[model samples]
Target chain A: MFNPTWAMTIEMVIAGVSVIGLFAALGLVLVLMERRVAAWMQIRLGPNRVGPKGMLQSLADTVKLLVKEGMTPDGSDKFLFNLAPYIAMMVAMLLMAPIAFAKDFRLWDMNIGVLYITAISSIMVISILMAGWASNNKYSLMGAMRSGAQIVSYELSAGLSILTIVVLTGSLNITDIINAQADGWWIFKGHIPVLISFVIFIIAVTAETNRAPFDLAEAESELTAGFHTEYSGMKFALFFLAEYINVFIVCAIGATLFLGGWMPFHIGNWEAFNHVMDYIPSSIWFFGKTFFLIFVIMWFRWTFPRLRIDQLLNLEWKYLLPISMFNLLLVTAIAILKWHF
Target chain B: MSGSTIIFYLLAAITLVSAVLAVTTRMIFRAAIYLLFSLIGIAGIYFWLNYEFIAAVQIVVYVGGIVVLIIFSIFLTQQAGEQLPKQKMGRQLFSALAAFCGLALVMLQLAQHEFTGTGNKAVEPTVANIGYQMLGVDDNGYALPFEVVSILLLAALIGCIVIALKSKPEKA
Candidate 1:
């Protein structure tokens, strides 16, 4: 006979499907948003040709990619070459599960959601390495190495910043952290030091995700599209999708930890305003905060020139790592002293 | 066995076999790929243990970090396609014997452990509990052990730096 566990298993399947659907939908929307934003920023018409306001540009691009030949480089490790994109995209999509969009709505609200995210996202470096190694190209290999080093170095600062949040919140659970921000977000509460940590978090995540300025991994001029140089079709699209998804994810986390996830902002003793703020649906607020962070990430992506590898490493080791360590000490002092707004 | 147990056993088998292959494979790149499977299997085991957090970390760290680093180093050394040099017959036989004996000793030790009165189901430790334990307040908390792990990490950090900084002799 069918059991409750079986029912739970079916529910899990549904959730998995929904997450996949969300990734595809979000990918379409984000790709369109990137084009429109880029166009607006540059004072150009952008893509009005595909559909209304270029709404279908990403769709058209998808079709183009699907129709395009999936070419493998001669003498490449064909099996791994083929497998790399799916692995990259799979890890990215897998990470979206534990993120709390609304109160009590997550795939698995593991007590270690934050840690799970940090750990899962770390795998992208592997996919990059695989793509690089299998391609049989020197540029790809170099790009992969740069990516590995960049991610490893930045991960330290990122982990440290998160540890400070964990210390202040007294919990690593995403829901608890979000709940902790109900009164006011940690950024505003923790004040200057938190702000500094937030800055470091943003920079570290941007570099960790391999976004521009820190995007030496695929330095187009130097590495010629870098690790995914040989990837094509939906495979290439997978990497593209995964990259944007990762951007959204880390920002979502930044929002959840620092920007009061589903919790709306209200100043002290403003009972009426605080009550009104509760009327807003949690999911909307969560997405609003996350998308705002996402826009800022995209803004940086378009704005900055790619960093040199040496400069990138120097930023982490010389600046970010030390600053984060110092910031952690400061936060610990402030928390222990109960000093906040 | 339940379906979960069956799947766990299958994954465990896959992991062990792939891990052996990963070490023994002559082709270094193939070995790397096999190692990926082995790590993925370990992640599955973490999931079975209900430490989804640890499982993800296993994937992100071992599958992602260490394996990727090894692969990149392999690439950097410009020896991706070449087969790894085979071990000498004597060394291979000796290592095989050592591993067999180690496995047998571990099996014997596990067999010697006695069962408790009531076979109570194990409760997975929550992240909060683990964190508290690490910070030294809980009854089960081994603060000294926690500090040792930190010291271990520090040692590894210094070791990595030393290795990275080691200078190669000038070519004649």
Candidate 2:
């Protein structure tokens, strides 16, 4: 059982470091970026006093979070209350393994990549519930309940929307999904139904990650700090980091599925433009597309007001579910008919 | 002591231990969390057996859907710190006996059988093959079962709607 080879051991260590490093970088950058974006949208100059245009503001915030005393409230369930943030963080980290970063670069390219991501992401709900209930705070419990319901229901539309692309490509492998988009992105090729599914995908994923306008889980005005109400210091920081990491990961998935994964943009019979697009590195294309989607999500956060709990469920169950289901059928027929470009 | 065998034992331990705790734990919420861990461990075993699609399906449906629902109901019916009364000694003994007998029977059957795998070939669990098998017209196709599942899900959806839609009281 202990016959681990030197190469495999080294690989595991390297991968472990990279995943943690990536999470740290993504958390720091995305949080700072969000604040700046929010400021700009509100017609105010965001934090420009920190390092160069407040670029290192997240670094300062991290230090503050680190220095603050971590506290567990009285009457809280000690074990579960402490364990919840790590559960959230671990789920997100495990999910990173199956995602394709650039061509031929992934931690683990499982056969059922999309499904694995969806499955693992669901654990976040349990962790939130744990945090909420263990805190022994009524508001925390309410927020957790809301989040659990919202995530579980929204998962249906998210899966269905993703199934639309899976129908087109005929594969669940992340790399295969990317390869299928080489000729044409799913957003453009499947025509009307595909376009509609793309919209549903974006909206569903936003809600799944608990971002606005679907962030009923953390309505600051109603429930202070939501599920992590009793958390402080590193524990709360972990939750915050997980939220941003989730945003990065979901946006990355969106980029890979709907937009082309690391493929350079190209048009039919546009040789010169395609060649120019190819000059840029594949990883840059991947990150660029991912960040663009992240910006779109952040824009939604700043623009749309928070959705009420009933309205959130109504949007998912009444609107997104049926529409995505219909779109799935259309994509199925189109795939069978060879109608997609 | 091979790598795969070791992994299997780890998964089995996780599944068994958490499953036991799920039934035995006093805290309602912790029991639900333990059940989630057990289901996830079973999903891991499915992955080890190269049933990747089935593994993911188990996770998505059981962990994602059912366990969440269970936790939701727990929140609705029970307070966070409130504990259920201990089971009666006779009932607990009966349940333990039932579980032990089931495990023993399964183990005995497994030990008695000489399972002849199809040349020990590891089937590549690809989505296209699964899709084809689901919709294929061949004898091995699962078109009937697939359709049956869809109908079953439809029924479940309708049942939930009927249960949830409460009629308004007559106006005074």
Candidate 3:
């Protein structure tokens, strides 16, 4: 039959289907949620006609995308133009493997799960570059270059912030990181330094994901649609999906690292509080923490103005990186001294 | 072929083909993409060998960091869309012959050695283990190498800052 490990193979197939379903559902709900949030911010009613409270708006959008013609710009590199969207989609899917949704539930709980995530997410930058370069347009190329510079700078602070949490937990395994916070989440447990790291992590990951005010890669006002200016229909949809999935991944990891991923709020030796928190399913708590973080990100998008390219780099290189590096040391001290409360 | 052997060969095929494509491609952009493929294929082999940490680092540093940097530079230089000039036929033939000789020599060297599988005792190296080794709390620790790398990185960063901040003189 030319097969190897039929049982594991079958399990992977099942997990693949579930992952696809989760990705689609999350995309639909987040898009709908973003619209409502945007409307609330702008004092307008958003997409309430299609379904109850515009729940089916994303579905309608999906159908429209499906029906639209997929096109390539006339002077574009045809092969890479076609390939760029898949590159983005595949990177997102690859990143999905390391996330742990519930107790003993994950695609691949590798020993270096967190590092794998940091590594795989970097591919998203390449996909953007490919799309921009292949579009054969000046604005697209400019957008892509801005993104390449932005992501490279921001990743240092992001990685350092994550390593801060890793120092506190003594492991890069996501589950191990989570379980270490059973007494209390890092934000609540590791005193002031962890709090600082958490803040830096949030800001760095916000920039890393290219959401506004850092969303200059596709900055609509200046570079109309940016790297994705030339992409239309399904290819654009893939890029959109990848972006949302990336948000979910980074937030989920943040929750896992700092918010006691799938961990309910438990105070030290507070028996009743611990019991109440434990009653909720781990998956629910997981998603709850993740969504709360996502909401925070969306709130950031609506509240802040887009940063200038220089301001963004200056924020990272000067402010975030130094602060994160200092926070890492403070955390390492807290970790060594056993000073965490 | 057995399953593991088949996988090994498949990964080898991907790595070799992509490396060749990376070298031979006319378009610089496609060459970079092919180099990405080759790096990822080698990472796949590391994953196959169960060196998960090394595999992750390989992807993070090479495919993700260096290749992206290369592509970014190409974009900056406005050379992403251009085709590289072809080498003369005589030079191409000479390089091809040299490449074959090198490959055959490496193959001969490899064939002289014996490789044993330790599948039954496969080591699942953890991040914690790496951390301990990096900190050098135990025997066979890498603390010196780690500190050296840190110093090297520090020196590089300082060099970068100095170079970037240096101003050019105005032409008279």
> Model 2 clash tally?
0
Query: What tens digits encode model 1's per-residue C-alpha lDDT throughout A20-97?
Result: 888988888888888887887788877898888678998999889889888888978887788889888888877887
Query: Where is model 3 more than 4 Å wrong at Cα?
Result: A1-4, B1-7, B116-124, B134-139, B143-151, B168-172
lDDT of 2 at A235: 98
What level of docking quality does candidate 3 show? medium
Report lDDT (Cα) of residue B103, candidate 1. Answer: 98
Alpha carbon deviation, residue A158, candidate 3 (Å): 1.0
By TM-score, the candidates rank as 2, 3, 1
What's the residue-level lDDT of B65 in candidate 3? Answer: 85
Better model by DockQ, 1 or 2? 2
Candidate by candidate, in order, the iRMS in Å equals 2.5, 1.9, 2.0
Q: Across residues A20-49, which tens digit of lDDT does each residue of candidate 2 receive?
A: 999989988899999999999999999888
Candidate 3, B1-172: lDDT as tens digits: 4567777899999999999988898888988898998999999999999888999999999988899989977887765556789989999999999999999999998999899777686434877677777787467688888889999999999999998996989899
Candidates ranked, most accurate by DockQ first: 2, 3, 1
Compute DockQ for each candidate against the true complex. 0.52, 0.60, 0.60
Model 3 lDDT tens row, A1-341: 53675655677789888888988998998999889988998899889989887789999999999899999989888889889999998888898998888888888888898899998888888899999998889999999999889888888998998998888888888889888988899899988888888888889888888899999999999999999999999999999988998899999999999998888888888999899989999999999999999999999999999999999989998899888888888889988999997
Model 2 stretches astray by more than 4 angstroms: A1-4, B1-5, B120-122, B135-137, B168-172
